[model samples]
Target: MDFEEKPFLRECKDIIEGSFGAYLNLSQQIGDLVNQHAQMVREAVSKLYSLLILTGNHSKPDTGIFMQLLKPLSESIMAIQEFREKNRASSWFNHLSAISESIGALGWVTVSPTPAPFVKEMTDAATFYTNKVLVAYKEKDKTHIDWAKAWLQFLNDLQKYIRVHHTTGLTWNSRGTPATASAGAPSAGGPPPPPPPPPADLFADPMKSGPGGDDTRSALLKELNRGTEITKGLKKITADQQTHKNPALRSSGPAPYKAPSSTSQPVVKSVAPPKPPRFELEGKKWMIEYQSGKRDLTVSDTDMSQSVNIYKCKDCLVVIKGKVNSITVDSCTKLSLVFDDIVSVVEFVNCQNIQAQSMGAVPTVNIEKTDVVEVYLNAKSLTAEIVTAKSSSVNVSVPSANGDFVEHPIPEQFKSIFNGSVFKTEPADKAA
Candidate 1:
């Protein structure tokens, strides 16, 4: 009779509400506006929403369902303008952004038995679609850019919603646990069995077996005495451990350059990493690869005409001193970027524990699959439109009038019931 809205059930409801149906609207004007694959897009959206309404919100949503929906939706969105109509940009962007929200919502819960792979696969999808959206990028057109901003705003809101509400909570799968689980076997990842009993003789039944009763008892006593003596002389017994025990058993260096005998197995060579990092200028893009643990690295003498791409760098600080056309940081860890403004977008993908600061105005910023990102926007770049999808622990700091930085977090925890006419969702912390 204990009904407290079982674990993560509310989160599921919020996700459903906050997403494209009850709590939010998949804007009717979107996707379908484009003549190409519009019906497919709508059908995919309808199917996804219907699935969410039916079972997703009552518990953890299915990752596979969302992914299946994502593929068609992504293909449709990417193809919105293939026949040429800028008006469709808004709808295309809107539909994709909506899917991003759904995907992000799905990630905040345990949808499958394997939580790690579930999150990872979902994250991969997020990154794939989000980055692939670049195929639709048209920087010179203001209207197209505006729609892009709208999409970014929606995505940012979804992220903020998750943070405010589910910081320490995860949506649980209310679905019944699999009956296939072996009840008799120790559950996976459970604690190890207790240490084995003391040797066989310690458990010998003196009266029933293992020699006559008197003899067994006497032998047990003698064994215990020997153990006690050994315990007391532990330091004496181990005294030569450093001088003889280790030297006798272990080799400190190669053994006298002896040739390998026929009995010895041939040494297997170590394999190199697949897809090693790259740093080169291909046309307009400056490629930086696998640079690690450097504090004073610089992309010097660059101007607003050049493009910079950083990949897989770790624990490093990269300073782009010159104004650049665009910058992209991908699959990197703990990387920092302090750079002048770009004429186009700044993008980050599949990265973690990373940050970037814009010293000048930038038109757009896109982030995907990355978590724990900190963005610093100075006064000149305050108007930058940031688009992040399926990312976590993200914050933007802008310079306050007093010359200090004031961090403004998007997607603050808040709630808005979907009204019949339209949904009006407001973030709780965004006003500050």
Candidate 2:
């Protein structure tokens, strides 16, 4: 018989494919718009510089020139904003916001006279957004994830451009002359006087002019290179998807059994062995439990030097004690974890009904694609990434070096999610 595909998986795949296709198209359009804007600015600046050289006017270009250069940037920003509004319900909203912010920074830098700081900011934002996309891709089998990868490449290229071209327009050279002064002869007094030191706040605002600056040509080249790479990756994924087929199941041969010696020996009846108990305890060192005809396991560790890994289990529990080691949980359900002391890392993925308790030194919790129900923690610090929790009740109390438990304010993000329920720790009995 032919293999039948699961409806849910197929539906998910189709949704991902559709979303990804739309994302790819929109991202390409936005990228093209940005590139065009960059190109326009470059040409405008180059032309303006040449004209200044010919006319020997070192003053800033008329406001009309600035307005003209800014038009494309404004339009691109509007387009991105529109895209964000249209896809507000998308799973990629956070990613879209990051990309939009990066593009907005780019727009600001384009119109700014001193764009060095803004360039750096734009690069950082774009790189951050790219990293977020990568994280999403690693967590799910969504097609739009590939678009994120492409977007990142494009952002990296933009970053390169900003770094190479420190400034977008003409600036005073070290000799106090306009950089374009090379087009004319030097003064009779040997060389022109050295340019005065730049103002202390020259870089304070990216929109103002500085004495000297860099250009955008090399950065543009990098952008072009990355764009080509994005196209190639997109095409490859598309082709691979077209060629791939649903998986098929194959049958195994019949089970083997020995024939009884009928003639020589009296027939002995075969009896099936009894199944083991659902729960087993190996002294105080370990315990294992099986439920619902499947293994719902738990592993407890007391040694701080050892690491723990739990995977593909349901209704699982993990207990940790001692100094601290890393713990990783993946593809689990109804998980309950307790950390008694300091831990290097706590990572969870594709999990639900999670309950974690922390006592002593704080550990960073990295949760991805997991839904958390509760977390009770006491530590010096906690870091959560890509973690979603329905409710969090944090009672912060950090033991000082002198052994006094000092209160630390809950992080803003956690407080917001918990709706201000985070507070000072109560007595142990009361907390329970």
Candidate 3:
């Protein structure tokens, strides 16, 4: 794995563990505080409105004061989401500065009873949250933002509370205590406990039956070859040993002959062969398009005993050829497959038919250009770019598009490509 992927994988593991759980607990605590404050504000607003209604005052009071107060609260929410969407490349130190500014803007909108202390607490929390996020952002750590968002939410709710009570202490959630810290925030102790390691055999070899008779094909041949050699060698060794043995002169010498102690058992050591190469999937259906002239071509599946295969990394076999009929190519690593050409031709004079099948779920095919007609499909939804053609006709019909099993007609120009190929199918069956 690359160094960069380490952090992402770590973050994914953290999520699977308990980091998300802590964030949720903290979020609820913060939401409760905010909820209480909002309720109070609503009550106050209602009472004032009632008074106006009772007095029959034709004039509206300056809601400007309330609007100004609500503005920062609303803007804070937007900023939080925007911060999350911020690219991983952005500097978190600069982020801290912006968050500080937002907190200052929010401070001016409401007056705290214990103004000095309240401001200090609010600023401290904001700075802490910002710094936490910055650290995570700079390191490309994802969990910090998740925790930050929860903290930001807590702060937002705290601000709402200040708008009402303006003096009530907003206690942090205790449930989110890190292993070392009483709160979800990191502590000054040594680094957090190392995450649990993934299973040792996570990538163990899998049992499989691939396309064609790929399963027993190689093993059968190899074992047969080994058995033949072993049998021949044993026969030769036995004949030589028998000829070298001295006949016992029982009557003349009255002696008994004994075989050598070391020769009693044959010392044969068996070692396994190296693992097979891996396969990867390239664009399975290489659309042999003919733009100006017919591009004569031939496509053929390798014989069952000698089928080709698609690979992932240069060695990891992602798909076995001949066994796989219709293949859907998606985001794949090493997007190329080695092929031993059965036949190579590029002319409109001749074409070949390749029989293929669709198994399990049909893989999704993403068509970018609309000018080309869709020949064979098994997907329920098909999207393309071309709707109309200028010189040549482009036909689009979704046989499976109507939820029916009927086969669609292949245009005269493209019938050769779709002759024996089936609709969509699962990618794992082909690739794994």
Candidate 4:
């Protein structure tokens, strides 16, 4: 019998060849964009970051004041982006000296502390001023999450420093908390503040058990179990398994206890680390799966990659250095993706917290059933159509004048009204 190509294989081959032929120039442009910009801006950003830390970092243990000192840090990132634009050809990543300065400034601070009341105020202020601080890194646009984390870290450092090194006998309080009175202060003497309340027994019963049975019936153990005793149920099954075929590794002991009435007592499986990611080129599609914690996954070849399928990855940074037919990201979380462009469409489905950047032109981008996705479109991809449905916190950042990224949220809200006889729905006009 003569061999016949299956419809699926034939369709894949046609899409690959057709996309390559149609968008070859776009592929080269994206490849150039990646190679040119990815390694150029690091040196400048590092120098700027170090200078901000050295000049703005103060030893004072006041969070509000320290956050106020971030003004210079905010201005310097904008300058770095401008410098990157001008010196794109000459700059390279360098060993920055200012890292040592940052370490020494917060050396006394060790543990994280509860945020002061002004934390919410400062956070709101930071959100208001996000336009000034967000700078474009090679393919990754710095999101508010990155900026907020830095602010929260400095706040924590200041809190810890106050706790550790502040002199005794003087109370340092947050914005709204009451300060302790210094020694020998005259009291307002009103019935001695109604006498201090007595401390409760730590192991008291909720239902008022007798004193003899209190220890055994106390709710303390149950309360602790409800919160912190998560590991008790995560015990792995110890029976000999079909997957582990080696007899030497098999356990000689009896099988571990499993609870009966499984309808009520459901077993919680122990977590095992996922296998390292694999990229297989099947026909014309690149299948990327099980990826996690990977920082620099590069697909540099322009000709070989026709399309991509990224599935079930977490906390991964994948950069495709060339244009392709299409890319589909499915069932992934916390993915940082950077690609040049696509011939057809770049689609995201059932994703969460995904941040993607397109350095070159794209025809269309689709996001469906996603949560908290940030898309950065460069000067080239400004005209790309971003079609979104059933998604939220979807923000798109495009370049504006003055070398800053202006972020705008994709409108998920709509206004429906009865226009005479029929009801019509359109995207909400926030301006109206």
Query: What CA RMSD would you report for each candidate?
Result: 17.3, 26.8, 30.2, 29.5
Model 3 lDDT tens row, 59-145: 221233223223323443344434434421222322433343344323322343443355456655455335434433445655445
Residue-level lDDT of model 4, residues 303-331, one tens digit each, is 42477778889999989878786777889
All candidates in order of TM-score, best leading: 1, 4, 2, 3
- Lowest lDDT block of 10, candidate 1: 178-187
lDDT of 1 by residue, 238-305 (tens): 65555455676447644566777999988999998766656566665677878878787788867676
lDDT: the better of candidates 1 and 3: 1
Cα deviation at 414, candidate 4, in Å, is 0.8
Alpha carbon deviation, residue 25, candidate 4 (Å): 37
Which candidate achieves the best TM-score against the true structure? 1
The CA lDDT at 364 in model 3 is 25
lDDT of each: 0.54, 0.45, 0.32, 0.51
Model 2 residue pairs with clashes: 161-219, 165-215, 166-214, 167-214, 362-379
Please list the residue runs of candidate 4 whose C-alpha ends up more than 4 Å from where it truly belongs after superposition: 1-276, 429-432
lDDT of 2: 0.45
Where model 3 places Cα greater than 4 Å from the true spot, the runs are 1-23, 26-61, 87-432
After TM-score superposition, what is the CA distance of residue 407 in candidate 1 from its true location, in Å? 1.8
- What TM-score does prediction 2 earn? 0.31
Question: How many clashing pairs per prediction, in order?
Answer: 3, 5, 23, 0
